[model samples]
Structure formats: C-alpha cells, structure tokens
Target: MLVPMPSEPSGQTPPASSLPGPSLPTPLPAIAALPAYVPGARGDAAVPPIKLSSNESPDGPLPSVTAALADAGGLIHRYPDMAASELTARIAAHIGREPAHVVAGAGSVAVLAHLLQAYAGEGDEVLFAWRSFEAYPILTRIAGATPVTVPLTADARHDVEAMAAAVTDRTRVAMLCSPNNPTGPALTTAEFEAFMAAVPTRVLVILDEAYLEYVTDPDVVDGPAALDRHPNLVLLRTFSKAYGLASLRVGYAVGPEALIAPVRACVTPFSVSGPAQSAAIASLEAGDELVERAHTVVAERERVLAALRADGWSIPDSQGNFVWLAVGEDTGALVAHLGGQQPSILVRPFAGEGVRVTVGSPRENDALLAALARWQGRTG
Candidate 1:
C-alpha cells in the first residue's frame, strides 16, 4: 500500500503535521537583475514598412537554399540532429578548419551564450566595448558572471588597446565585434594583433564577425586565419546576414578543440533545427553566388555612404551592410520622422547614441535618402 499526500480541510487549516511544505519557487537573483534585450521595432502590419532595422540582407535566400528548405519541410516531424554534424562539417571545410574545432548553433548569439556558459561563472568578469552587441552583457549576466564595458573611441571604433588593458585577473572572456554593430568600422589586423598580445592566454577572446561578409575593407582582421596563431581566439560567423537566411537561424564558431568542446557541450540539444542545417548546407554549396550578392550589398553601402556624406551627414566609415548616424539627441526624432514618412522606414536606434540603417534595395535606399533629405531641410 502507498501512503497518501495529506490534504488540508476546506476553509480551515489542519494541524501543522497535516500541512504541506511551502511551494513557492524563486528564480536566480542575477536573472531578476538582468536587463531585457530589445530588438528593433517592426512596422505596422496593415501597411508594410520598409524594414532596414535588423541588418538583414535585402535579397532573400539563394535559390538553392529555398529549394533545400522546401525539401526539408517534410521532415519537420523528425527531431533535428543533436550534433548538427553535417552542418559542422561543411562549415569546417569552408573555413579550412578541422571538424573538432567547429560548432554550430541556432545563431551566432546562441553560440556566444554557450561560450559564456562554458567559460564564465559566479564572480568571473566578461569584458567588451560598450554599445557593442547588446546581447553580450545579457548573456554574461545569465551565466552568473559580471559584465565590464569599456567605452568606444569617439569615432565609434572599438578601442582595442583599452579593451586589452581592461582585462584583469577575474576576466574570463573578452569580446571583439568587428564591423562593430550600430557602429560600422572594423578592427584592423594590426590593432587586433596588438590587443591579443596584451591579453593573457588564459582569457578567452571572442571575435564576433556577424557582418564580416559585408566588409570590403582590406584592413579588417580575418578571424579564421588568426585562430591558429592565438589558441584563445574564437571566431564567430553567421548565415543570417550574407547568406540571406535570417529566418533559418544558423551560425557557427571556430576555435581550438579544447575551447570549442566546452561550447559544444553547453549547446541545447537540437536547437539548430533540421531545416536550418539543411538550408545552411545548401547555402554553403551556393557559396560563390552568395559572395557575389554580398559584394552587391557592399557596393550599395558605399553608394549610400557617399550620398549621406554629400547630404552633410557626419557618419562613420561604415564597412558593413549598414551605416551609423551619430544622431545623439536627435535619435528619437529622426526615427520618428522616418516612420512618419509617406512610406514609413524602420531603423535601429540606440537611444542618445546613434541610428543604424541597413543597406536595402535601390528603391528603398532612395526612399530613405529622400526621407533624410526632408528631415534635414525641416531641422535646418
């Protein structure tokens, strides 16, 4: 015979012996203090807005990728491969790295979270430039680690030297976002090497190259090529931007086996859905065409930059698929003005700092330029 759980009498308490224990469950204190990650705003559904907020490619996924997705659609009933083995292998081949050194996740952000979990813990410090990827601090805090931020240069580039100096005994992870988000200039190879030399080997450094494919600058540090020279370095890249697979959510990391093994261990099982893996494999197969598309985006970015400068906007030298306006106090007003235009435009704004405008279709770019011209006239 099994013993029964005691129940209290209706509207009355039984003796203390008959009472159950308190059932309230509390979350981690760090979680309560965590800052929410705010994504870029989506426009009105009734009338579609030109979305240049998320830095997504103007062109949709490649033809091969679309066909692959359609083929994979039938397999949704089955669970994704827990290891994401084939995707990992393809990414390794593309980068010329061993399969053991590569790990794929739902997105580069997810892979980054895994890195934080593997290397950071209570009392450890994770360091990066301020106004970089907003997710950095959030992921650090979620891992029960402290986030330390150094200010970016006035020109909106990462102060690599300052970031290196900021690392201390407690610093377990340091992040570098090349073609830094919301700000466009990438870290030059010389600067990156100098920073790496200053950092202790024990401290892991992540080079986030989410927008790297969009970069046309010759001076930018090539993360994969630098990996072998610095065992502590982890290179992160994504399929969302250049491959035009934002909806699929597949990204990868390359580093030494020791570092990568732990990150792989921390990944949630089957987080990289089956369709995502299949699409990524197909995207890799269509690599040359994708590169050509990326070059087109870079070309458009240059055209937009030239136009903005001609219009008297003092923007940074953007190397990614977006331009950053150091709008400062005008951020809210500028964003609102753009949204209020005949065909509203959506952009990513970092309150009081700047606005990031993705390079879109030629017509969309022209619309954005017109809106900016109107705003400038009005404000002047």
Candidate 2:
C-alpha cells in the first residue's frame, strides 16, 4: 500500500497521517534549494566585451594534446579505462607523489565536489572565505552541509586568522582558493603554515591552486612540501589554466591515501573521458614548454594592470592569469555598459561589482584597454 504523491510543479510531499504511506524518503531540502551555476557569457552579442571571464587559458590546449585526442578517437567507442591509471601515474610523478596518493577526475571542480560529498553532510559544517571561489558554497550546500562563510579582508585576500577562528568541532573541512578566483590574490607560505597549525587535525584543509601555474610569488606555498607534514592537507591543481586544456576537462588531487581513496569511491567510474586522459598525459610530457606560457600571461597581466591603474581604476594585486577590477558599483551595469562597444569584451562581474578580466593575447588585451579608456571618459 502507498500514499499518492501530489503532481504539482512544486510537488509537496505527503504529510504524515492516520493512513499508511509510501516508504520513499523525501529528497534533502538543501539539495532541492541549491541554485544553478551561471557560466560566463560568450559569442558576438557582447559589446566591447573582451571576455576576461572564467579564468581559462587564453592560448588554448597544446599541439601534443590535440594529437593525443586524435589518437584516442578509436578508443571512444568503448568505455574509458575506469582507473585512468596512466594519467594518474603521470600526475603522481608530475606532483612528486606516490600514485596511490593521487586521483584524477573529470575536472578539479568535480573532485572538489567529491571531496565535500565524501566528508560533509547534515550536521557537519564546511568553512571557506565568502569571495574565494563561487563554487565552494554551492558544492558545500549540495553536499547537505552548512557553509561557514568568513568574509575576506578589505583588500580581498583570505583572512587566514578569521577562517581559522571560524572552525569548530562540527567543521569537517576548510577550503582555501589560492590566487583566489575573482579576487586574484594568493596566500603566502608562512601565512598558510601558521593557519594550518591552528586548525584541528580532524578538519580537512583544501588548498585549491587552480591558477598555480601563473603564480610568480616566491613566498607561495609549495603544495607538495605541506603534503607530508599535514596528512589532512589536500592540494588540487588543474591543466585548464596554464596548460590551455580547459575544454578537455582534466584536473587532479594530491592528498593522503585515506582522503584520496574515499573521494575516488564517490566518482562514477570512467567520469574522466578517453580524450581528456590522453590529453593530460601529453600535456604533462610537454612540461615547461607547456608551462612557460604562464610567463607571457603574467607579463601581459601586469601590462593590463598598469593600464587599468593609470586610468584610475582600483585593481588588486593579482598573481593569476586574470586581473580584478574592484569597482564599488553594480557589476551588471558595468558589464552591460562595456557590452555596447566595438570589438566587444566580456568580464565576470560579481555581487558588489568586482569584475575579473582574463589576460588574453596582445591584440585582445589592446581591445579591452581601448574600451576601458572610453569607459573612463564616459564615467568621468
């Protein structure tokens, strides 16, 4: 015997009553309430839009990666290798960790979700800075966990001390996005070390270095160096940014075997596609030739920053491939205003008007600069 479920657009679950009811449990309220992710805009409709949105590699994937993808064409008819053994091994060697300590996922973001799902749930708390990565809170909520958002300091860098203070016995994880997305600032090694020391051993600490390649700061935390000392520390990196493999969707995690294994269990088998695995391997082999592109992006990012500052915009100290324009206005207005100009440009604008612009080729960068100059004239 079963109770009937109402078939409305906003279906209401049957209330407890004197009559017998269906045993099916209702879906978690948190899961139902999560918002859909809004990806950055693209295509010609955008005006003066030099899309510096979504911190992707401006140069695109490597030639070897394209060749590997071609080689994998025949293999696509069959399911990909479930383990992604070769890619995992190459990633382990690349990160100087044992293969058992690494896990490959469809993307770094997917792995981050897996980590949260594996470790967090109702009654558990996940802590991170408010403006770190937009995905952090979404993933935390999706995992049925409470999100403890500590606002970033005035300059828009993670206030490590504040984040550390927010942790409680109920906290299962603390996530830090270095060279943090949108803001483009990174945590120094000493600051991170001290912060880690303050956090309890039970809580997992995630250092997401998706933009590690573009980092030129000598004081940046070395992901591997902290791994041995802090078994709870997990480092996530991606080929999407500097290696120019965003479309391929491959990223990896390096952590203790305990943490790595559970997250691996949650991943649906063969989530990483055949072409993605092949391309990642090829990119790893290419080494510095693939990584050296960061130099160009870093150099160009500075040039972009200089131009923005000269025009009287407040720009943050960005070590990533993108620059953050801290305009204390509505980002939608700024984005729309920029969208009406020629050789259009697009940027990722957030809640309070912080816009992130990617460092593109010289020509694309010049286009953005011209638009900014015009925008300054109008606003002045």
Candidate 3:
C-alpha cells in the first residue's frame, strides 16, 4: 500500500497517450455522415511551389491593411469587441445599409451557419443547388436540419425553376451563390427576381456574393436592390476572397433588422479578433487600391480562360476568382499529373467531377497552363 510511484523524468513531459482519462462521450449520429471539407493543397516547406489552389487573391494585403495589422498586434492581451460595432458601421456605410442591419462573423460561411442555427432545426428543410459550395450540406446537417438539393442545369448553372418548385412546407432556408463556386456563372437579376417571386417569403433566402469584387458582368443580380424589395433576403459577403485577408477571417451579412438580430445572437461571442477588424476597416478605406488589384486578377483570369478555350477546353464563364474544368471522370488523373510537374501546381479538385484552378499571377498561371499542356500531350 506504501509503494513509491513511477515519476516522469525532470524537465521532460509524459506523453498524453500514457495518461488515463474519463470515458469520452460519443458524437451524434450525424457526425458520421458529414462529408469532410477538403482544403486546397498546400506546398511543403522544402519547396514553396506555385499555389493556385484556394480562391485567394494572387496579391497580398494593401499597405494600409498591413499597417493596421502591425498596430493591432500590440493589443493581443485584450479581448476583441464582442459586437464588432465599428466594423458593422463601416460595412453598413459601404453597402448603404443601416448599422442595425449588418452583422459580422469570422467569415461569411460562419455567418451562414449562425443563420441556420437560428432558423433551422430537426425536421426543417434547408435547400440549395447541388455541386455548389461544398459547405452547404455539411452546414445544413450540422444545424440538425435536412438538405434539399436541386441538380444544376446541363451547362452547369442553377436550375432555378426546379429549385423553386422543390420548395415544400418544411423548407426553412434557401441559398443562392452568385458566380457559383467551382462552376462560376453569376445569377442574373431577372432569374433571381423570378425565383424570389415563386418562393414564399416565410422562408429565408441567402444570396452568397463572396466573389462580388471579381464579377465584371453588368447583368448580375443587384444585391442591394433585391434586399430592399425582399424582407427575407440576406446577403453573405467575405473579405477573404478578393480582399487578400484569408489568414484573418472577416465577413458580414446585410439584411433587415428583424432577421439580422436573431442571427447575431447565434454567433460565438468575440469570434472575430481585433486584428481582423482592423484589417477590414483599413481595407474599406483603401477601396480604390482594392479595385486596382481586382482589375489585375480579372485581366489574368480572362487571359487564362481564353487560353484554355483556345486549346479546346469547355469551361464555365467564371466571374469569380477561379475557373472550373468539368472533366467528369478525368479529375483524379489530371490532378495527380498537375501535382507532379517540375514546380508542382496545386489546384482544388472535387473528385469525379472536375478541378477548380484559381487565377494566379501571370507567372503562376503560366506554370499551370504548361502543366496542362503536358498532361494533354501524353493523353490526347
């Protein structure tokens, strides 16, 4: 009874695996069925390869944003503003909305999750187009709701009529991603208006415009105008995609005060850091500089898109920061080959569907095009 204990060596830590712990609880059944959200491939430290995977800006943050980040670093000991009050005000002024109607989260995706948690629950149906944003179904199920998906058209566009018709009494929310991710064709104003007319206002409609800055098409849905006419309409926007702030998540939603109030309640307290808020506010001040960078990326995207088309590839007219290749069965092979190139180009692939190539800088894009040519030479 008086035996001495075996102690860990001084100045060394015992491995966590060696410790005995209480019985862990099992996760909900839904966790087993959730599809993993695979991130874009990253390069190893040995070789900093060309990165064209994520839909990130090919450029870095603005000078003003960097300055803000440096200044905010000194305040790490303090908690961030839970309400993000100043950020809300700036977003409202930029988008011409009242501060009460705007809410900020770590990212737009987070904002969407908060909306779902507030309005959706077991037995409630959340609807969206198939093969759109990868997080749609995962988020829906996580909210303890069912996901109702309508297939995209043959040409890779939302079948809005089918989606509107699929709405049922149990439907609580519907999402529309403009310049739809991984496929990239923005919804026209007319298409959106018609869809809205058919759906009941009792159901919430989220129009995700994460790629708004990269959109050059004039006929795309007028988001602000739509929000004014539809009480249930809310827009999800992000600073990650084109604002060059992917490292610091900063996104917002704009809608009527009635819906925004509840969504704000669902957010995790102090979810956004002080540095993130600083960068976003500074980004707003440098709107002119942001547009210049967007223009550069848009030009490169057009050039890459043109080259792909000229070489006999059929791709969607992507208005977003990336382009999609609907290579159905050839996805795995193409991605594998691209990853093996001299400098190694990494792109996002949705196995068995196609690949999504971010529009990198001209030099990076050139590397991608060359690798594609090599792949075709061996296979074609």
Candidate 4:
C-alpha cells in the first residue's frame, strides 16, 4: 500500500514518499531518506520544447569534437583508458598542473561521488551550504556520512564564515560551489581566501566550478591559481557546460596529489567512455570557439537578469549561465504559466523555493521573457 503523504500547498507535486515503500531486503536508512533526483521538467508539446531546465550549453559539440567522437565510436569494443592519462595530461597542461594533480571521471558529479567514497564514511560529517548542488547531500548520504548545511546568505551566496565555523572533528569534506546552483552567486576571491584560512587543513575542500567558463566577473575565486597554497582544495570542472558535451559526461578534478590519489582509486573501472575522452580533448583544442560561446551565454544571462530585475523579481547576481527566481510558494504557478505556453518552456523548479532558468538561444529566451510577462499580468 502507498504511504499517506501530507499535501503540498502548491498542489503541483505529490510527496516523494507517497509512492509505495520499498519492500524485500530493506535499503539502508540513508539511502531510504535520500530524495529522488528530480530532473528538469520535459514537455510533450507537439512543437519543439525549449529545454532551459538543466544548465546545459545551448550550443552543440564543435565539428572537431564531433569528428573525434565519431572516430572513437569505431573503437567501442576496446575498453577506455582506465587512468584517462591523455585526457588528464591535457587538463593538467591547460591548468599548468602536473598529471598527478588530475583525475578524470564520467562527470563532475561522478568525480564528487568518488571523492566522498574515498574520504567520508559512517559517523563523518560532510559540510556545504544549503540550496547548493543537489548532489552534495545525496553523495554524502551515499557515503554513509552525515550531511551538514549552513543556510545561504540573503543575497544567495555562501556564508563561508558560518561554514568554516561549523566544522568540527568529524567534518571530512566541505564543498564550495562558486556560482552556486539553484541560486546563482559566486564566492568572491576574498571570501574564498577567508574560507580557506578559517577552515582547518585536515578537512578536504572541493570547489565545484562546473559553470566556471561562463563567469564574466573578474573577481570570482580563481580556484586553479589557489591550488598551490591550499593543498586540501580540489577543483571540479566539466566539458558538460561551456564545451557543450553534456551527453558525453566528461569531467575532471585537479587537486593535491595526496587527496586526488584516493579519489582516482575510488572511481568505477573504465567509467569514462573512449568517445567521451576524445570529445573532451577535442573540446579543449577548440577552446577559442568554446570561449566565444561562453561569452554569448554570459551576455544572454546578463540580459535575462536585467529584464527579470526590471520586472521586480528580486533575482540575485548570477555568475553562472543561469538565473534564479526565488518564487517561493508561487513557484508552481510560474512553472505552470511557462509550461502551458505554446512551444512549452520547461525549466528546473525547486518546489516552493525557486526556479533556475538556463540562458538559452535568443529566441528561446524571448519566449521565456514573454511567458514571464504573461505570468506577471495574470498575478499582478
């Protein structure tokens, strides 16, 4: 029998627990408590759907990357390089780091999982700011570590001081998502330096810079440059964003050799496919085109943010390629208005908290802006 669930005020979602409880051999409590991942909503409209739900680049793989993927596809029978040595070397060279400092994985999310597996365990505390990456707490729980979170500052940025202060003997990993997801404000250079200073060196710090390529601000924490000083700090980056290879699932980490070694060891065998590796390398070689595309995304993001703020939405300063709308209880209403429109605009909604709208092509964004205008008319 299905479990009884308390109704949500928005009336747009059924509680996750409303589904039938798991039977047979019982799952672990942490696993049981973990919220099911809610993917960006997809619309079944006859017309093409504007999928700005995930923070994916609107652009596709560059011709070079596509050719590389095609070549690698012919060699699918052979296993991928488990060490991903060539890819690692390319990333290291790009960041002026040695190969020992890098580890390649399926995606940054996979790399994070491996990092947690290597460093955290039962009774340990994994710390991060609330409303950050959805995967942070999930991965912590999966590693049997307790997830601890400090609320985001009013401006929707990390309270690094609070995070550092919250650390205790049991804290194993502390994650900082610059240009934090869902709500989009990055840690400034001074904020990051202060955080690193306040936190103990014994605890590992992960700076997930998945959206790094789109950041136009000159003062966001330069994570790669800070690596030498903070040996405990690791940078997680991906081809999935600016390089436009989301389907390939290629990402990597650069960090101190000691912390990276165990994370490398914990990754699943041959998880990153040959095509993904080839595509990632090719994407790196096509860095110029990627940068141009990233610039366009940033420009559109600024335009969108300006329009939203002019509309009096109270959005934060988003350094990422997406913007956040803290719509609160009206989240469902906003989502419904957008989704119900012709051509159907879909996005990522965090229940009653907010909506994350990825900066898409000019036309798609225009549709989004129009939808919001209509929503405002209906509500206002």
TM-scores vs. true structure, each candidate: 0.93, 0.91, 0.94, 0.93
Question: Candidate 2: global Cα-lDDT?
Answer: 0.85
Off by over 4 Å in 2: 1-27, 45-49
Residue pairs with colliding backbones in model 3 are: none
- Model 4 regions lying over 4 Å from their true place: 1-23
Tens digit of per-residue lDDT, candidate 2, span 134-240 = 88889999988999999988888999999999999899999988988878889899889989999998999999999998888899888899898998999998878
Candidate 3: give its CA RMSD in angstroms: 3.9
Look at candidate 2 and tell me the lDDT of residue 23.
Answer: 89
Better of 2 and 4 by lDDT: 4
Q: Model 1: per-residue lDDT, tens digit, 204-288? A: 9999999988887888998888997999999999999999888888988999999999999999999999999999999999989
lDDT of 4: 0.90
Candidate 1 colliding pairs: none
Candidate 3 on 19-56: residue-level lDDT in tens? 75668898899977899988899988698878889999
Query: Model-by-model lDDT, in order?
Result: 0.92, 0.85, 0.93, 0.90
Backbone Cα, N, C clashes tallied per candidate: 0, 11, 0, 1
Per-residue C-alpha lDDT of model 4 across residues 31-80, encoded as one tens digit per residue:
99998878777677567789999988888778898899899989999999
What CA root-mean-square deviation does each model show from the true structure? 3.9, 5.4, 3.9, 8.3
Name the top lDDT candidate: 3
Residue range with the least summed lDDT across 10 consecutive positions in model 2: 43-52
Cα error, candidate 4, residue 332 (Å): 0.8
